[model samples]
Target: MNRARHHRRARAFPLAMLLAACAVAPPVSARVQPADAPADATKASVASEIRAGVSGKLKDFYGPRGYWPLWVEKDAIGPQADALLALIASVDVDGLAPRDYDPRGLQRLIEEADASPTPKALARADLALSKAFAALVADMRRPARGIGMRYLDPEVEPRDPDPSGLLRAAAVTPSLTDYIQTAGWMSPFYMRLRTARADYRARWGDLPGITVPEGVKLRPGGNTPEIALLRHRLGLAQGAAYDRALAARVRAFQSDHGLAADGIAGGQTISALNRGPAYYDQQLALNMERARLLPGPWVRHVVVDAASARLWYYSKGALDGTMKVVAGARESQTPMMAGMIRYATLNPYWNIPPDLVQSRVAPKILKGASLKGMHYEALADWSANPAPLAQSEVDWGSVAAGRSEVRVRQLPGGDNAMGRVKFMFPNDLGIYLHDTPSRDLFAKPARHFSNGCVRLEDAQRLGRWFFGKQPVADGSAPEQHQPLPQPVPVYLTYLTAVPTAQGVQFLPDVYGRDGD
Candidate 1:
């Protein structure tokens, strides 16, 4: 993507666009009221009740406007009211409960006010609509339970939306429809999830429940009475004998559900098939909450979804490309975080983490293993320019016993753990994306084998995307720092429930972060 174009789009919509209007209009008193305006006594009564009824943000919002109704005009609900009510009704698409907003109650209030436009009735309806709008905006912005904070790293803090400012903007915007739809209130990624949720609900909301009996293992090229039931469960054609085609379908299902894709309808696979619509519905809701922690679509960034072991490059508010990735193993689970990739290190040395050195390398070295053949060396310190230390000078027994510690690093070569390059984000957690010599892991369906760092399937491809060309090393140097033209943001997130063409794919919670 063009740098200038990216910057232009990035600055096009500021966060305040949803909170505050671009140009403040004249005060409510400066504008003339409609011919059907209520009597002064009734208006005073309504304003007094509004002031008494609302507190906090709503009170502040309406106080400045003389308690005037934003959704009610000329004793009738305006188009803005209809639009807002419609949005509230469809809050389910955003993984929000419509009941929480009381859309039906709001609708009933509107109907009553329309039937008899009294001051008390109109005031009640107007206040209800404003409260509903505020609640919806709040939930969309920050979400309940801190936007899935339990599933995220402690470093990631979700930002809260300003309800008063949003309400003020909604009042002044020329077209409430456009403001609600295109004013950048919700993140584009969140909107995408909304669409996916709607699609999944439309397709699989009423999916039939089918349960193949437990303790029954059906493999391909086998004839059994349960084959027909299995086919029915998988949405395949009825067949008494499990054939190649059925097996292929079974494999696809197994892969999607995070099971071993051996094309066998084993107990686990059968259990997954029996996981009805309710499971997916809850999964989608959980993932939608998780999406709140992601960077907005306007920014140029790379997203690593730890759940699916995938990496996506997003530029110009759209996905540029994607590739397979290997995330942290269950034991050393990858944390959800956001950072900027400021530079890349070519011919990077795999600085073995201290913990790994204590657990793996120290034991081997104590067993008389040679570090030179492994391209490993001990560093005197972890400073920018630390001197190398001879292996003979180090006490391996104390290191393995956790009584002492030393810094160890692997030299840049074919046998190096870090293949050729490493993208540096520089966080306290010491997590970064790097090329790995172990490429076979990428081909696996479940690729969480790292120790809390992300391993790129094709570091050269990512380098080309990041630097417009693959960075190279002169072989004379190791840990060559190549600064990027501009820093690109990287967001590491987890989404156990991923949207797919057929329906939502519920990946296994490898780290058990999803509370499943």
Candidate 2:
């Protein structure tokens, strides 16, 4: 047999034995107490009920431990049980329905067990709490279609927690409270969403709505009657004329809502103002569902949020720095994806995509546009070692008409489309993070002006974060590949509602992917 087949059988052997042991183990009442020696009748009765109530994975977990209570001791609910119940009661903060976990029913069971201290009541409460925890774990890890988790493209599958493994770990933990709180069960990003949701509800859950009339464009130095309504809606002092202070507040509001921060009360800004706390709440809930698909916090990784046009670098599981990024335009929308960045390419060539060359470049060249300053070179074919050809040798008309094909590349230089360097993560989708020569676009508030790839604002800074120092070319080679000491995972996600220090900032769904 092959080595892989042998390895599979080797790993399956122990699992089979463990399952058999769990299936054949004697009941806790029989193992823990003999027929004549029922010194602790209450304990024996509770263990027997617990064994009869649970099945499947829960049975496997409890049977091996003599059916002992996980959440009760000495006929009283412990601190761990209290903590779990509280979290379940307020689980809406995590975009979860509290009723699904039945927090009220669990509480009633706990109260009855506390008052009468009967074996049946205690066993029921213990089983209920364990089942609630398991349900929570399953919900947090899996993306639910009912909660707006249906994506156009398949996302990176989240790692699901093992039920038996979690129970085993919780059984021996020193502090079950700490274990439930910080057990790496949910994604750290999801926790951030929870905090944002709670803060938003506390601050603006009941914010009164006051809509400004349409077609009212209030500039900074203009006097208008509509300015009064705008100021009131923004929570500023009532004013009749548009002034610098009101403009500044409007600009801040516009920035937070993903509008152009030009201090002008235009159509888009006024429309956003009309959408009060209800719209924001829906955004938070949708984003929380999206966060469910993200992996747990990593020691070293990069997160590129396309909706916000931003990038965050995490080192040792802490945010090291953030920078601006230019994502794909609406026409070529950037996709949500995740992969490991294995290396960096210095002085990289911008190999134009066939579609771009056929649609954009060939038409221009056909109209007598010079390729001298463009630094473009036409190649015979798209191979590792392709022969160079003059621009005039190719049939531009045929290429532009989609009747022919050709390979084109731009030499490394200041005017090259791909500026300086590019981080490579090989995938089926031809998308990677790279620098750009057009730095002016970064100044715009809504920066969505790329074909599909992500353009970094500070490529050198990101390079230094990846490799202790920036990788430099020797000035003699056209392209140089530098492998990283350790590969870092990069998650490209689209979060329309992002958490901020003050509260959640709702960004524009530029790609219209949010379905809001």
Candidate 3:
């Protein structure tokens, strides 16, 4: 029951921040009907507002075919419009603000219609509602700040989900909401987390904070006064005893939060248990934002969950295997990006990055003391086409002093940094997945030791899968490159929570990238 106590204000969204409000509508002069407003007036206002302020891609989509009202039938709000409003209101379930999608002027129109209003107001409402509906669908389909906010899918350009097409289909379809929901590519993990959040907010959200001593450690079959507080905090009924049931609950909580499920309440597990409802809610919110950037299902792919330092392989959209990984350290964080693995290289050489050379290797090797099993190369220049210089011809002091540019490369050998192979997915960031000789580091609970690239423990297996043949394990003299039978997409993502058999397992944010 020991939990950190902090009050968090509920996030506020101003109605003025609604994007639909920025649109300009056509002037309506005559009285309009709710069920059968003037078709021409509705069309004019809807097209003008959408084209003027919705989004460039959407605007271009409708512009080619005269701005027709997508969600209006008989000059009134159609079934599609009704379903859209319902979905917008419940967007909060997905950690999005419903106010962001509220249709401008729709409320006023509803009031006026009740009070026997004129036709022009009704026409204005219909048009505004249609435009707002279009904007909402667009937002729901992409990242919050648009696709540009995403670092993972940088190459995934923002292609507008043609709202006009969706509206047309939804108009004739009875299951409009269900059809629209299909467009979102939310994973099972996200859906489960959403369910967990809703359940937490409903039951124990208002419970009084309970404190557990920081140094207290409780094992199974051990009795302490804090057991009562723990039962109450965990929603157990009063008069509960510190028995096997209490131990089971503790183990479940630890497993869900990525702690060792030993049924022992230690300081780390206590801290995780101590997190209040708001903390969980905020984590879910931030993760939802990260999920928005992810691409949809792929038949076969690789995913690196940077937060957990794990690599997952999927076949036919199902997770087939996984392995431990070493991600970037805190100062040099692994970035979120997506690319296609086109090839693999066996006996790959490690061309040391200049920054690492200047900061680490140069400082140690400058004293002219050769390190064990270390190979240093002096280059004519730091450029890609640098000429090689023999070890005896180069002055180590001058290279260390920055007076001369030297290229430091470790040749392919038993002790090479890139153990036996490296997977290449060409990207501007100079990051890739490769093997590391320091395989023992992967056994650590937190594996954030790499400079920036991802180090894989199962590089040989991955190589075999990609190349359709086993890689040379002996670190042969010449490096060999083989293209994959077919390119497989790789997503380097940062997801902290994933649904497991036990529950939603929340991994530690090794990179400290989770803003919450």
Candidate that scores best on TM-score: 2
Give the per-residue Cα lDDT of candidate 3 at 305. 71
Backbone clashes in model 2, listed as residue pairs: none
All candidates' lDDT scores?
Answer: 0.74, 0.75, 0.63
TM-score of model 3 vs. true structure: 0.63
- lDDT per residue as tens, model 1, 1-516: 001110001112233432232132324553555542233333444455565577777887887877766665544556667777667777767767988988778878877776766556767888988888888887877755644333223333455656677688677656666556542455555666676677666754654577777788999888888888887776767778799888987887676555678999988888877777577677777787777666554457788989899998876545788899899999988887777788999888888988889999999988879688668999999998999999999999999999999999999888787788899888777789999989889879899999899999989999999999878887758889999888887888888877655444677889888765
lDDT over C-alpha atoms for residue 312 of model 2: 86
- For residues 1-516, what per-residue lDDT tens digits would candidate 2 score against the true structure? 001110001111233333433444444434543543232344455666677787877887787877767776534566677778767767767767989988778878888777666556778988888888887877777775654322222334444666766676566656677667653455567778877777667765665688889887788888777888888887778778788888988887676665678999999888888888678778888888877766555347788888889998876435789999999999887788777788998888889988888998898898888555468888998787899988879999999999998998889888777898999887766789999999999999899998879999999999999999878887847778899888887878889887765445677789898785
lDDT of 3 by residue, 212-247 (tens): 556788777766777777777666666436778878
Error of 3 at 236 (Å): 3.8
Q: Which 10 residues in a row give candidate 1 its minimum summed lDDT? A: 1-10
TM-score of 2: 0.67
Better of 1 and 3 by TM-score: 1
By summed lDDT, the worst window of 10 consecutive residues in model 2 runs over 1-10
TM of each candidate vs. truth: 0.64, 0.67, 0.63
